[model samples]
Target: MKHLPTSVKCVALLAAALLPLAASQAHAATIHTQGSIQYVCSGVGQGSLQKMQAQAAKFNLGFWMVKGPQGEYLANVPVKVMQNGKTVAKFTAGGPLCYLKAPAGTYTIEGRHDGQLRTIQAQSGTTAHYLRW
Candidate 1:
């Protein structure tokens, strides 16, 4: 086989190293439309919610929402998870409840329902929030 020039070889190696990163980025979570907002939701049905609950226990962070008083599952509510004042994830409730995989730290979770805002604090072992309209 013929040897390539040093510069060409470096460029090829760089591209090879970055290919996986690019592919991963392409597959990263994406914004999805559920109801009134765009969000990256993870779980879908009852089975997914169960799986999320298990994962939440292991990952130390999870999020979900429900309607107030009657405690119905709230779907399609716009939710934003912020850590240290910077938004880490945005999701619209795909179901009456949704679970989020976030880092183990304090997060300010804001949910919008019927033009009203409901904010709450999330931390390890805290996953559920009640949102009112």
Candidate 2:
């Protein structure tokens, strides 16, 4: 009898473990609005992740909160989406993944965790930032 190689088996196991996260690309999160901007912060579970992933394409920008080398997920993060010199949107994230629907323009996305602040630049329709700290 032939058996699968150790490396092949490991890869299969890793893929299986990540199936939930990888498979979910949209979800059913409530879309919240801030003035003219609309957003959703959801991805805590498989269902939510699936819904959020689906909803993400409608938005211009997205964020994923991550930490450490292993890439652990963070939740309820403080987020601020700034355009020009003013804040267009700000909220405590509902989950690890969040999407923002803003006008087509350059914006700064900031996330605060444990007193450490991280920022990234995003172009309305073409950026997904992973806030790692």
Candidate 3:
């Protein structure tokens, strides 16, 4: 039997280590919105939001939402996730909170509730943004 070279062995090890990460990413959250107000049932819900949040943390992206003044979860708010001044995702809040999985970078998150437009910035990592309306 022939032994592999050191460089080839290192490359093979790296690929092996990264394979599971790629596979998990492929199974990561998929966001879908409907009527500009709500995420499709298949994509939005408490459970789904949790999954998205996990993915956002794993990918070093933004994830968070808007809330009411009295600490109530505000629903039906329209939200837009923007990067580089271009709208990337748009959806309506099905509950008081929503989850976003954006690329690791600066993002402008805008949402409207109770006739007011609220905007905030979301950063990468495990930080969660809770905007009050």
Give the candidate number with the greatest TM-score.
2
The lDDT values for all models are 0.61, 0.83, 0.59
Candidate 2: deviation at residue 38, Å?
0.4
- Kindly report which residue stretches of model 3 are placed more than 4 angstroms away from their true locations once superposed: 1-30, 33-69
The digit string of per-residue lDDT tens for model 3 on 27-78 reads 5455554332122212345365565545443344433444555665556678
Model 3 weakest 10-residue run by lDDT: 34-43
lDDT of 2: 0.83
**lDDT tens per residue, model 1, 3-98:** 998889889999999999887555333434433323344444635555444445434444556666766666778778777898777766666544
Arrange candidates by lDDT, highest first: which order? 2, 1, 3
Ranking by TM-score: 2, 1, 3
Summing lDDT over every window of 10 consecutive residues in candidate 2, give the lowest-scoring window: 21-30
Candidate 1: minimum summed lDDT over ten consecutive residues — where?
31-40
Compared with the true structure, what per-residue lDDT tens digits does model 2 show for residues 1-133? 1398988888988989988875543335778999888988875675677667766678888878988899888988999989997999899997888888888899888999999999988887774688899
- Highest lDDT model number: 2
